[model samples]
Target: MKTQQRVGAGPGRGLAAALGATVCAAVFTAAALPGTAWAAGESPYGFDGGAQPIKGAATSLDARPLTAGQSYRDSIKKDGKLYYRVDLGTQENAYVSVVAVPKAGGAAEYGDGITVTLQDGSGAQCGYQDSSFASATFTRPITAYAHRTIEPDRSTCQQAGAYYVLVERTSKAASPPDDWQLEIRYVPEPGVTQNGPTELPENWPSSSPPPPVGGPQKRQGGTGFHDATSLRQGEWRADIEPGQTLFYRVPVDWGQQVFATAELGSSPTGATGYVPNALVLSLDNPARGHVDQNTVSYDGKPATLALDPHRPVAFENRYSSHSTTNALRFAGWYHLSATLSPEIVKEYGDRPVQLTLRVNVTGTPKAGPAYAGDAGPFQVTADDRDAAASGASGDEAGTNDGMVVVAAAGIGAGTVLLAGLGVWSFAGRRRAARDAARGGPGGPQDGPSPFGPPPPAW
Candidate 1:
């Protein structure tokens, strides 16, 4: 009779079970790493990782509610109009911005764009803004904003009640039919204890100043408003690829005037073909409201795009009839975005084009209005000033580089740990099976096992 033997109760089996648990733990550790490690290569128009997914209603009746100081991600079909609701207090001003990102390499007409409007429940329009692809030969992300301001003399949209943000896409028959991704942000400004002059400044500098003088500092631009690289008055250098956009922010305090110029270097491949609106540079206020924009054509040659001379940041600028001046109503991080058209990919090869940014912030900083409550994200704090001066990204501030290094190291270690554990687990199982077949711990060895040498004693 064969000797009685108990199956699945030996030390080898125990070791195999423990190894499986170790493998799982290794995987968990890797998964817990900070997500920003992978963000470096993400698309410039990608939505924020922390943005909440939301669906916009076709009509105001079913409109979703948007909270202040939060971002929501959604999509809009061609020619589709979507509505969202926001409840506001009479003491605060609400600014809403919508960013529409078209499909990469998609067909788009010059007039294709998006419109945003803020209206009262009774259909009274408070503010409206629209952005277009303009002369761009290819699709890219465009932004527009609307606001509901509580002014002393303003009549409409002043009540402390619900307001609707209407977003409408304008597309031609030749435009791509795919739905465009949308990033919606709502920023609320508290009422000021003391109001500034309501009249626009009569005598402000209107001439563009000379560009900043210095050697260009290497700085990697961020993807969007949330991650815009911080820069002070200086010339910064980076690279741009076709269909890519880079965002940077400059802290413009009250009484300070900011100017920027974007220069695109000649094509690397020397490929020659004229493409209209090949490069576009835009400026937006702290609320992400469009301030001004300039575009230039490209033909394998260097090109420069400069923004119009902007007035200093002042509370009275809000009363100006000019959109550029009106947008300079607050002191905060002003965003600068540079976009290279996809048409360059066809005319010029896919090589990254060298780009240089000349940024100038002049004038002494002045005191801001006293707010009844916290000034929220629109106010530039001491930390923000420091970050800008040090040339750091907005999200990570001063520690972005360190965090990236730590994340890379952690990832490397995790990969090695997981790989080692996987090998050990495989070897241990093979050895356990071989020993079990031979009858127990003191079983006979049948030459060298095929899997590998037995796992080292743990």
Candidate 2:
């Protein structure tokens, strides 16, 4: 297919690059403004995450219970399909994600695939998806999440109450009998809050089309930004094998813009009919809503695909090119998910593909409006440091009040020095303690994810 069009050239592209750049710039400028940093409110709707391990699949008709706004992880053996029971409210949205990890010394075949199904209590099927290795050998972790049920008004599975999640290997026997790790989390989005950003930037170019791709630029990482080993201002490195998907989370504040590119290491030798676009990188906004998708094509050299929103962050119109609207309307932990083409793995054999993921986060985290209700555990206003202190239950002291007070004192003292210091210094002191309790850097564990087409039938 031809490369993506320039921003705002097509329908809905009006929210094109202009929206991207100007919105990001305005957000950042607002953040940098004095006394605006601490006012940021956290998003009230998201994963109400509390994880519990599934001991094993229930035998017979018995299914393990899964709670909404919680997460569960466990291992399942080959040919073993685990079933879990879910009880959801009529207004609540349910999501489930299953990640299949091949055991050490296992076949390591990237073509291995799995099937996940959601069924209502009365034996009616609600939703189902099959994920494959996609013909690549160097496999990374394969993950998939989808809403368990259609919206309440929909015809199918409309009622709330008991539902089932079933997971089983779908790949051929040649792949080997490896144990797979299953991370399952069900998120219930509180239906009460408004679904869009607090505000849109002025002079947002509502009438004009977006310009061409902006050239590359440099970005600097803010201090105390590395809490979850998240992608920062500069570039980060990762290795992905075919059939495997790697995930990285970058915290973007209300005003900041985020741009990322995945450079595939090298094309496999003697591979033919292989599409140059061997890699697929997807961006999910803070609420785990998919925003953009791009691919790295391998011509003679490593093909780089810009995986940012169209216009403002990068020059390419990935929104139109990918045929998906950019839904990056909010701030928080936007996730970068990378996967390789199975065709490459089929030809190259299972081998690690070196990749450089260049992530650019521009703008600053300005304070957000304080909502009437408590924000979930995840806060977009605070960086990794504050997120760490909040922990899963979100019971940290001096949250919004602490930051604002400290920042005000620093400003009065006539120094951005203490401004930065006040924002992160105390938070940094809690880092060691938080890390010890929360464990190391990890991606979002909750499972509700975008539902899309499965791999083509063989």
Top candidate (lDDT):
1
Worst 10 residues of 1 by lDDT: 1-10
Question: Model 2: per-residue lDDT, tens digit, 301-370?
Answer: 5667775443232111112223222234334566677766655655666787767667655543444423
Q: What is the C-alpha lDDT of each candidate?
A: 0.72, 0.47
Off by over 4 Å in 1: 1-44, 398-458
TM-score per candidate: 0.78, 0.51
Count of backbone clashes, every candidate in sequence: 0, 22
131 Cα displacement, candidate 2 (Å):
2.6
Which residues of candidate 2, in runs, are more than 4 Å off? 1-51, 56-60, 104-111, 148-152, 193-228, 232-246, 252-259, 264-303, 308-331, 337-355, 360-379, 384-458
| Residue range 1-458, candidate 1, lDDT tens digits | 00111000099778667655655555444333322332554334745544667899988879999988777889899899999999998888888899887765555786888888988889988888788877665777778888887677777888888899999998888877888889899989888887767776578777777766656766767767766877877777888888888889988877788889999888777677998888889888888888888888988888898887878888777666676777788878899999888877787778788899998787766777777887666566677766665555564552222223234445455444554555445444544553344232221222331112212111
- Residue 278 in candidate 2, Cα distance off native in Å: 7.8
